[model samples]
Target: LDPFVDWLQKRKIPRGLGIVIIYILLFAFVSLAVILIIPPISKEVTQISENFPLYYEKIVNGFNAFKSNLESPENTEQVQQGLNSLGENLSATVSNVAGAIFSIFGGLFSVLLVLVLTFYFTINEEATRGFIYTFAPSNIHPYINSLHTRIQKKLGSWLRGQLILSLVIFALTFIGLTILGVPYALVLAFIAGILEIIPTIGPLIAAIPAAFFAFLQSPVMGVSVIILYIIIQELENHLIVPKIMSKSVGLNPLIVIISVLIGAKIGGVFGALFAVPVVTAISVFLRDIIEKKVEAETKLVQ
Candidate 1:
């Protein structure tokens, strides 16, 4: 069965088909997610139709403005303006509400999806190896296998260290918020976990909202958020980062930072989130090819 599936995928399906399939699956998942999570859009939906009266007034005013403009010559301009204003307000309201609901839990959904995909890839290690071998030259198999092993080692080491650091950060964040009596402590902690996906700027961005929301509730709570995030971020940079990323993929910290920012700029949060892994994978393959070239040159010289 495995051989048949592999053969079919390789022969019948284009090489790009795998990436396309992954994207389609991702879209389907996100679409279903949007549907399942749609109810939260208007808390009005769950708590019953609260916006009905407001919507009714808008409709009524819209019609009234249209009718008055059509019938009364002297009031034509004022009525036209009223109708236009109403239309603009309705459009703005819909946009804002849509933005708010979507922004509410944006990265959380993506983080979970990435984790799911990563876990699947990790578990099917042999299948991935076989798939890659199918595309490589027979004599190059040994070199590819060796390089893949090296990448796996890098992945395992990085993931273990990252998890430890993530837990430490999560603990500090949750404890600080709890101590300050911040509302939605659990939610904030969860947000921190999700934000930890994007390097550097993620925690900082998450912290801003925590501080802002806290400020809305109480000035003291807001101050606490600022102080807590400051300490956590500093600790992350000095202690956590060094411990987890000490002997990185040999990329400069500056390069990693730049890649993350560029990725974020390109694809928003998901881009930033996947940037490091993608960078690491590409680096490994490129180095592997370079090493093979070096060996070939040395043999020629000999």
Candidate 2:
């Protein structure tokens, strides 16, 4: 045992272990950045898409009438009418832009805040890992270490893959909502993007806004949002999820549902946020133990 321990000390863990750890840290840093960065960006992007459209027609008519006056000076009545509309449109557009200038200014500060958070995670990854490692007992250090590696692998893959899935889901949702001429298409899309992070309940949470805002605007828009979410959710669950889940983490549908339900019930946004990662980590460890036991039994029989 001493000779084996001495050999372990002399030989050192493989350089590959260091590389993998670094890669995992980078992955976590970037994933956390997306969580931090995307929410604000989505808010700002949706705000631009939402509030701008509030005066979109005003902006459009302003430009159209201004152009008509320049192009066709022959008809005084048309030119005068165009000029009048242009003036009204311009007045409305100017006020809309001015009213939201404070929000635009505030947005810059939010961007900086996200950047600081992401950079902090990237640089101090080791400290964070150490903190997490302390949660497990010292007697089971090796077991906990193995579980830690497995959890990171599962989560990193899941998060990276989920990024693609969320974007696609958001894009599809946006197109459908926009086509239905939903009042706040961008806001719906942004909500869909964030909710898409959570496993089962996410899409439902996102759909509520689409339905509420749409129902307020028009019943048809409300129905459209519901149908759109259903189809998109189907596509995400059946096609995208199976295709993209790195290593096919093979979580039972029942387990996924239960985890999301319990998570949402317990901690609101945080529980939903962490539910899948916790489940995935547990699933990884269970699989590892099963595989190891089977191998040991097979070797003993031989």
Candidate 3:
């Protein structure tokens, strides 16, 4: 904040005007990005909405055909019972899916609210930091400031790295699907990109529908889609994640999985999406505290 103010002061531009100009530019960049991404996303969404029922119908028919094959006299009762259970839950499943779809729209307002708040914070960065400093004791200010800096660095890096990873996944998925002659490549790849936000299980979720769609075309194509996604996931896990995310996140796979599960249980998709960063924050703070305590203890002993 001081550096920014000094830079503006050097140029003889008023601090307030500089801040406002920076905010405006930031907002403009964000708006442009949103505008560029939204049209293709909306097109894919619309296509999915219109065609999903037909896909579901085909899936149901396939399942029924499979069930018929299990109707040997010896297996009749077991198959019938399983089918009955599935039939009973079908409505509930549809209702849950509908609710999830509706929840996606519910997050739009939250995104807008974040953008607005960010604009305010950017314009008043020094004031906000000073106001926060007022509430803490002087003795702890240095530690608090240090912690804040570390958190910001970690989180900023994490977000940027995640964004790059998602973009890479989106490009690979789209290109692979296109080359394979898969229909709805744009939509499937977009889904893959967006779901990359959730680690561990996200890629698998994105792959299911893609494979299903490919299978609808032909079995060989289905196999190709599966192989393509497997290659993508391998590259993501072994290559991209190691290069981009490992340093930024610095969390074990087990911890991430646990945090994601807990977050999903508590706040659904939004919780899961943010769980890693929240855990990262906590870990960073605790790590800093422990190191400071050890340093203080060493000094006392000396």
Candidate 4:
């Protein structure tokens, strides 16, 4: 079956038939993914949209109640000061929230556009590569081609691994939240899934609201939520990440952190989403160059 598919990919089949097959496979895979994931996603998004203000109210009320329970006059003063600051920045915060929503929708559109473009390129991979190579100098064309292929494989693997990781985290989060009777479990879990793209800090950020909500229910529950999040993070790091992302990139933790920070600084969420893959591509190309140079010098000495 693999050999036959390779032969078909090499264009032994009629062009129209091959195109049909490609579309059929693409459709089937996409359909399967959507069928499996879209219902929970739609439910989560709908619930969040409808109840966001309610959740906000809960958080505000929780904070206010906690503030009232403070014994020290100094503590009350600090709380009042914090409230005043929050009020003063309310308009700016609202504006930032609107901008973030706009950015998220824009990013979603861009993702769809990219997926469409990728499908076209996948169907015409050789032609696309050839077109790119036409811009390169003849002497360096082979090197460029090799580098492109390596980058493509690295990025493709990374993307698939990332999707799997995110889905797993989302499922784990939703299940845990549901068990813990956390309100907005679906919404929080969705956020966790989306933030999983941001690498090291993503899970921690996802855990914040989960813990806060859990804390709102009870201090003990909150503590439990924190512990749950820590365990999930451990599982993701020690088990899921090793299995899924082991082949994707070779960058060390320090490089990954710096790249994520720089990416977020430059392009916000979109930049951060792409940081690891971009770094991986650059690292792979540079390593290849160094290896070639070393080989040349060794040959010269011999």
> Which candidate's TM-score is highest?
3
Task: For candidate 2, give the lDDT of residue 271.
Answer: 65
- Per-candidate TM vs. native? 0.51, 0.48, 0.74, 0.73
What's the candidate order when arranged by decreasing TM-score? 3, 4, 1, 2
lDDT of 3 by residue, 1-302 (tens): 33454588689987778767766886798789779876776677666666766766776677667777784765766765775576456545644654776788787765566556655765676687688889988888788777767776676677778788899999999999999999889878988998897777889999998997899778899999999999999998889988987668456667878997998799876676668768888989989889889999999999
Better of 1 and 2 by TM-score: 1
Candidate 2 lDDT trough over 10 residues, lowest sum? 1-10
Candidate 2 wrongly placed segments (more than 4 Å): 1-149, 246-282, 297-302
Q: Candidate 4's residue-wise lDDT over 1-302, tens digit each?
A: 22233568687675446656766886799789778776776675556456555655665686788888888989878877886576456535534654665676677755566556655766676788789778878899888877877887766676778889999999999999899898778768888998887768888899987886677678888998888889999999899899989887645667878997898799866677678778988889889989999999999999
lDDT of 1: 0.68
Q: After superposition, how far is residue 61 of candidate 3 from its true place, in Å?
A: 6.4
Give every collision pair in model 2. Answer: none
Better of 2 and 3 by TM-score: 3
Cα displacement (Å) at residue 9, model 4: 2.9
Q: Tens digits of per-residue lDDT for model 1 on 1-302? A: 12223444676764345444655686798799567534443343322234434544655665675676586675776766776786577556645755655685687777778866765664476788889999989998897788777776665556556666666776788788889987656556656866775567779877975785577566687887999999999988888788777864445455668888888899887887787767777778987789889999999999
Over the stretch 1-302, how does candidate 2's per-residue lDDT look in tens digits? Answer: 11222344466744334444545776699789778756765565456545544554554555566666575555656766776686577557645754564664555554455445544543455575677668867777777766776676666666677788788887888888888888667666877986776667788888875785666565676787788889888888788787877464455656777897798699654565567778998788788889999999999999
